[model samples]
Target: MSHSEQTIEREIVSKGLTAPRLTPTSIDEAIKDEHYWVAPGRRLTVCALTLRNGFIVTGESAATSSENFDEDLGRKIARDNAREKIWQLEGYLLRQRLHDA
Candidate 1:
């Protein structure tokens, strides 16, 4: 997490609104499986994550120049993008759960 994000999370935790309820560790654990691959015949990396509840989310990373394409870097970027989406989705789910409570 970025310094700013850590600060914000500390503030929220201090207020007891939403902190321990939806944590980064929990988010990481919520994923049941993960997969990554480069697009055939292209310099694009695709990441797929399957949530514990069987929901799937995908993210992609592309190289501007084929000459500079690095498979390892592309996979990292793509997987990070996919995990970021999971954060957003899980945040929404937590909000809904709070509302319904």
Candidate 2:
């Protein structure tokens, strides 16, 4: 479901309930920029997310075996890890807004 605050408010109005939730679109919206970096040996990858407010969050992935390291997979894993952090942060913001409302 769309997770914009407006959308959630509408849902609550119609449903007569309150439950703050986060959605993919909300996460995507809060992210102002995204970047990735690989370590010198290419066995580790880090993903950085720049939020709309200019704060940065990062997550990383490391390969236990050099032979199994893949740049594409590492980027995906690292990005996912970073996105998870975004979820937590966004969730907190959502809950705070709901509480204040």
Candidate 3:
């Protein structure tokens, strides 16, 4: 097919790797609904896990104050933040699992 089509196919296959062993209910749940918080006037929440392998996997739908992010800047920001949080959580889980072992 076209170069873009091939690129998309490769991307899809590459993402199939690093699949988690256990699919926890919350693993696919939205970060915001999972954890709620208030920041005085503004509130923030996580809606997905950003994988180190460069995959944006969502356990639940994302929430945003903006009506539309056509430029996708909001998506990029959310993905970055979620990825950081997911990485941190993964580290914590790994340590805990090892400790339990």
- Candidates' C-alpha lDDT: 0.85, 0.83, 0.44
Residue-level lDDT of model 3, residues 30-96, one tens digit each, is 2332222222323233345544444554332233553432224444455544534554465567668
What's each prediction's TM-score? 0.79, 0.77, 0.34
lDDT of 2 by residue, 1-42 (tens): 224555766766798664557657678888899899999887
TM-score, candidate 2, is 0.77
C-alpha root-mean-square deviation, each candidate: 2.5, 5.4, 10.2
Q: Can you list the residue pairs that collide in candidate 2?
A: none
- Ordered from best to worst TM-score, the candidate numbers read 1, 2, 3
Model 3 — which ten-residue stretch has the worst lDDT? 33-42
For model 1, the local distance difference test gives: 0.85
Best of the candidates, TM-score: 1
Ranking by lDDT: 1, 2, 3
* Stretch of 10 with least lDDT, candidate 1: 18-27
Whole-structure CA lDDT of model 3:
0.44
lDDT of 2 at 43: 93
Residue runs of model 3 more than 4 Å from their true location after superposition: 1-70
